[model samples]
Target: MLKYQQIALEIEKHIEENELQQGDKLPVLETLMAQFNVSKSTITKSLDLLEKKGVVFQVRGSGIFVRRHKRRGYVSLLSNQGFKKDLKDFHVTSKVIEMDVRKPTQEAADNLNIGLHDDVYFIKRVRYVNGQTLCLEESFYNKSIITYLNNEIVSESIFHYIKEALGLKVGFSDMYLHVDKLNQEEAAYLGLKEGAPKLTVETIFHLTNGQPFDFSKVTYNYEQSQFFIQANNELL
Candidate 1:
């Protein structure tokens, strides 16, 4: 195994041995680097992978801590831009499971203002925390606006690529949040029992010009994460 993966496994073993628990702080980066005889970057990557799997979390200036399974709650959406980066306290990682160009469903076509016969980039990604799947996301992007995308960028941050590489300004998005029972595919991805309750969010993203460019549905493991909305103004 890679050094980083090895380190991640060691950390997980530490947890499994009951040496760490939720609210327990992890060793500092320097300490871990020295203990593992790995470079700082390798240690960081291992911790990052663990964080993505919901194993541990970081506090900005404080330090990393073991994440209790029940104590974990992450906001599904932050703003109109789409997909909050509030995971600063955690090591976030993702895997692009599948990517394809295909025709959209009627709803997806309408939301993205594309034709049902026109092609869209259909991307399926699983976000992990502490080696466990946290969210299963299937996103459809307008081929015209997004232009080009690959698995690498998909696994990282599509939003960042959209802004930095494509120079497209993301305007805002409309989201519908609800609870539903997990389907077969979602259950398989999240390793949840069939029919388990799932926290779901459907989103439609628009560009600065008010043109819709992306549509996505995210299914989260309710047992591992929680979601909430904060509003500054009342809706009329």
Candidate 2:
């Protein structure tokens, strides 16, 4: 583990052991100085690292205190190593409402590898987290494999649907992240004010059978959400 990570774990242990609580001051510099057996610079770096990760907050002179707890479990499909996550953990409700065929726009055509006016299927959804607006995801699938979308059995995560229900192999996807000013319509869907800043992630998902199958664009508030990645030395 990285030194900072080890420090983080130590602090977490302290917190778990009730040495710290919400709004409680951490040990003073002189106290930590003796406990960690490290230089002041190293200790400071570790505290700063914790502060940046939202695990701790520093008061002007009172010292650091526990702030937010780590999110705990996060899994991303592209990395392909974590346990199969149950979407229920997100505390979000997702409904895939409409799926229809439409002609691709010039930009959509380029993203999905379809002709400018070629037929494509549009999958629209509204996702909520903890009963609050979270994201609006619009997925476009290549017409060939999109026959599955014609069914009404759309579930929580589209990736899971394609892989399990249809017995399709999924792997390798490209993602693009960007920030944009939200419009009134999108903000309404997300329960945010108009012109709010939002982070958008667009992904082109490909299947292991040598085909690019899905393109999706999702918009959500960055201030309200985050992402996590886990690594293992063991080969996946």
Candidate 3:
């Protein structure tokens, strides 16, 4: 990781470890520079990164402060940490509906940049947060890249396994968000009526080497789902 990005994560970790509330002021830039043993420009870059992520905001005269988020629920769209890590404060659990190695579907093949004849790990799961059904996810992992998977890993966090166990570096993802009505199967899994509106996110996750490893579609219960994203103004 880049130095600024590392510092940005460290600041975020500090906020979480200290249980800093929204609007709580972080230490001044001088203090941060002294603490992190970096120069002013580096600290500024780190803060700018955090600001773009909606973690903190700067004031003309006041110090940087934590940004308030939705009180009910939130999911960081920019983060690849998976639900288990992102919402560590909540009870996040996964029920593996199905898991098997299968030939890649056309969509999966294209998204994962694998051949149609390639075998992939097909996984279906329902994720719950605080005992409430949040989303149903269907994913395909390129077997060549992922190598191995099992029931235990699927029931907890595949990303965790891919990172810690497999020792792979996750890079970024391309995501598309849309609103759709639930189908019968999705409705049944979420305990919602058929045709209920839901938020659907389709993503292709790539590794640091720029190889697409996973393709997934996640349908979230609209009433319980809130998504957050932070973008740099330069991207505009």
Candidate 4:
């Protein structure tokens, strides 16, 4: 992890451990600098990241404050942290439906930018949030890039494994979202009727070097899922 990221986590932990409520002021910059033994620039970067994550907000000429908005079923569309990390306050579990190594399909090959003969790990799983079915995911990881996987890893967070275990930097993902009806198998997994409308997300995940490593299609139980994205004022 980067210095700023570690500092950010520390600040978040401080908020949780101290039971800081919404609108409660966080430590001043000078205080945090002394607490973390880091430079002003480092603290600023960490605060910036926390602001982006909606954990805190800044008011010009005022100290930082917590912004603990209660958003049940809400997920950040811009985050690549995956469900487990994103929903850390909630209980998240995965049921692995299928895991296998196989030759890439044409769609997977094209999306992952690998050759037809290259191997890929095919994963099918259902995710539950707080013990309720949330989403059904089918994913392909390029064997050459991802290197390895097992039931234990897939049962938790693959993104965590790719970063913490493999020591790979996860870059941006290109995601497309649309509403579609679920097929029979997908509906069954999500405990919905066949042809039920679902919010489908297709994503191509890349590494920091700009190499595509994973492609996935996720169908969410519409009533159980909500997503949001943070945008800068400059975008408006």
Residue lDDT tens for model 1, 1-236 = 68899999899889867757778988899999999999999999998888766678778889999875443345535443333344455666788888999899998998899899988999998887767677999999999888899988887778889988999988878888899899898999999989999989899989989999999998998886765443222232
- How well does model 3 score by local distance difference test? 0.89
Clashes of 2: 0
Residue lDDT tens for model 2, 26-103 = 888777867888778777888876765555777787787886434543434344321234233557666676678888
Can you tell me which runs of candidate 2 are displaced by over 4 Å? 1-70, 73-90, 231-236
- Give per-residue CA lDDT, model 4, range 105-169, as digits (tens): 89889999999999999999999998889999999999998899999999987888899999998
- lDDT tens readout by residue for model 3, 1-236: 79999999999988978878889999999999999999999999999989888889898797899875645446788777776655778998889999999999898999999899999999999999999999999999999999999999888778889999999999888999899799999999998999999899999999999999999999998877777765555676
Better of 2 and 3 by TM-score: 3
TM-score of 2: 0.60
- Model 4 lDDT, full chain set: 0.89
Cα-based lDDT for every prediction: 0.82, 0.70, 0.89, 0.89
Order of the predicted models by TM-score, top scorer first: 4, 3, 1, 2
The list of candidate 3 runs beyond 4 A from truth reads: 1-7, 17-25, 39-45, 57-65
lDDT of 2: 0.70
